[model samples]
Target: MKDTEKISLLSRLVAMNTVNRNEIEPAKYLKQLFDDAGIKCEVLPVGEDRANLIAEIDSGSPILAISGHFDVVAADAKEWATDPFTLTEKDGQLFGRGANDMKSGLAALTIAMLELKAQQVPINGTIRLMVTFGEEVGELGAKMLYDAGYMQGVNALMIAEPSGYRICYGQAGTIDIDLESIGKNAHSSMPALGSNAVDHLIRVLYTIKAKVMARAAGLHNAVLNTDTLFNIDVFNGGEQVNTIPNHALAKINLRTIPEVSNAEILQIFHDVIDADAAKYGSQINMHVEMDLNPVVGDPQSKMLQLIQRVAKPYLLNAKFSASDQQQNQIVTKMLGRELPAGTIPALGAPGGTDARRLLVDQPLGFDYTVFGPGNFTSHQPNEYVSKSMYLDFIKMYEELFPAYFNEA
Candidate 1:
């Protein structure tokens, strides 16, 4: 595919407001692209205005799958310098809501698929693209796809999350919990008349910070080289100032490592709540809102080597041909650092991706990596992607698909 075609497709994708849902329209648009290419594609609706698209080059063993999500996090246009939905190219960067987070990666993958089909590249195995929605909120779309047996496959998978050309062999898992403390309401004039739920919750939070979190900090994974991250993201209590608050709520998010399992993490919260209740007669309820296990790929796996090898020249050169200079300048700027002369990409990702859902059942069975363009700017105001990096990744995927399937 030409660079013009790539930019046009990405612009069209970003123009659609798929903030939370309403993925059906984009799915249809992509389906039309595949149909025009005479490729086999299907749009599977998961909910009203929400859907998943699956396109294939062939059907057989040794299947290689690429996964990406089109739905992006909500963006307030007022906060951005450019219209968040319109793909604006300025200063060699593409500014848009989903541009950095994923639409660029998704578009690049689509372009690779289309290029391969158009070229009539010979493939002994299947190359599939699983387009999903609702990845930012949770891996809801991926879960639905996995539960429906979309992952019952023969081989490797790559999640095109924003990683700035790095190869992420492992990513931290996450669990979101909602904890509510319930107590009796009474007048503030009588200090001891009401058992203040807010007070009880404060104690619980303190205990967790002092005991549980400190212990989690010590538990680290050698591969990921990171310890578990614990955060009390949201807290709410007290409707009025005069009355003692009868109820309080806290939303907790934990980025777990392989060293700690989800079951064990949940038990820690349970133990904390139980111990606090036993001592202070506090009524605290815990509800698990979301749970996804960590994904760790073999560092020495063929898939990792393949990606590392393919990405080496790009990391070293940091620039494409003279004809592609305009699209190549953003690579260094986006990463905020120069790639050490011969350094290969590293193995850890701070954020989670659809790999969490894909590998939940057989966490260690598949070869998976989070490899793509873009960076930490994702989900922030003025979210943008390096136009050069976006163009480079498209060529990389085009090369990788043929090499992985031995069609070259």
Candidate 2:
């Protein structure tokens, strides 16, 4: 596929409002693209208006698996300079909702797969591409595929997760928590007559925050660096100003390291919520929206060594990160690269990815790496990816695919 074709495909993908919750149309489109090229593709049904596209180009055996998410979180186009659904190219950047988050990576991989097929590149193994749905919503499609044995024979996984060309060898785990409180509604003027759900929920939230923060303190990991980060990202309470709210909701996000188990941290939340509920005399409910384990992939994998060999010493430049400079220096030195003062990508992802399923859970026992043209500005409004960076990513994959298959 040409650069123009790849850009055209990405534009069409951005135009579709396959909001993280709805990815069926885009999945179908990908399947059609594959079918036209005589590649075997399957639109694996997920849920309503959502599907995962799996396509394979056979060489001899299945080995390396590459994946990306087509579904993007809902975008508030009102905040964008142009329609978020319409891919806009301005000053060498392609602006759109999923452009940076992952759609660009998806496009690059698809184009690479097509080029490989067209060139009839000989390989000792097959190349599998998975365009999954709901990566933004806790990697639902990846979990589904993993459960269905899609990762059975894979040897390695290369995920295009927009790390600005840096290789991500590990990903933090995640626990999505929701806490709610129920009380009796009454006029705002008569505070004594009704239990304020909002007040009760807020009290519980503060307490939980303190406990979570305390739990995160002092612990550390060599790869992720931080112990754990927790935040109450979403909160909802009340309907009208004149009446006291009878219900309240708070959603918490917990990014975990490998040292702690999901269940252990979850229980701490449960205990805190239970205590607060009884103290406030309100009915409270807690829901675990999603729980994924952390995965530390082999940083010394031959796949990564091969990529760095081809990309060069420039790929080793350090990207300023929130992580401490000492930690960054340590990791860079470990990779057998001299640390440069120049900007580089984060050593590890602070948030979760489908890697929680692909690598941590041992579905295929595969080593994995994530690198792409996309960056951290993924879910924000007016997200974009540079054309040069995007094209470079495609070229990287093009070079890596044959080298990887032929070498190993």
TM-score of each: 0.90, 0.82
lDDT for position 14 in model 2: 89
Q: Report, for all candidates in order, the number of backbone clashes.
A: 1, 4
Deviation (Å) of 344 in candidate 1: 3.1
Residues 72-101, candidate 2: write the lDDT tens digits. 888886899989999999877889999988
- The total of clashing pairs for model 2 equals 4
Q: Please give the range of 10 consecutive residues that has the lowest summed lDDT in model 1.
A: 320-329
For every candidate in turn, the CA RMSD to the true structure comes to 3.8, 4.9
Using TM-score as the measure, which candidate wins?
Answer: 1
Q: Which stretches of candidate 2 lie over 4 Å from their true place?
A: 60-62, 183-207, 234-248, 273-283, 313-338, 341-346, 363-366
Which pairs clash in the backbone of model 1? 327-388
How far out, in Å, is residue 283 in model 1? 1.3
Among the numbered candidates, top lDDT falls to: 1
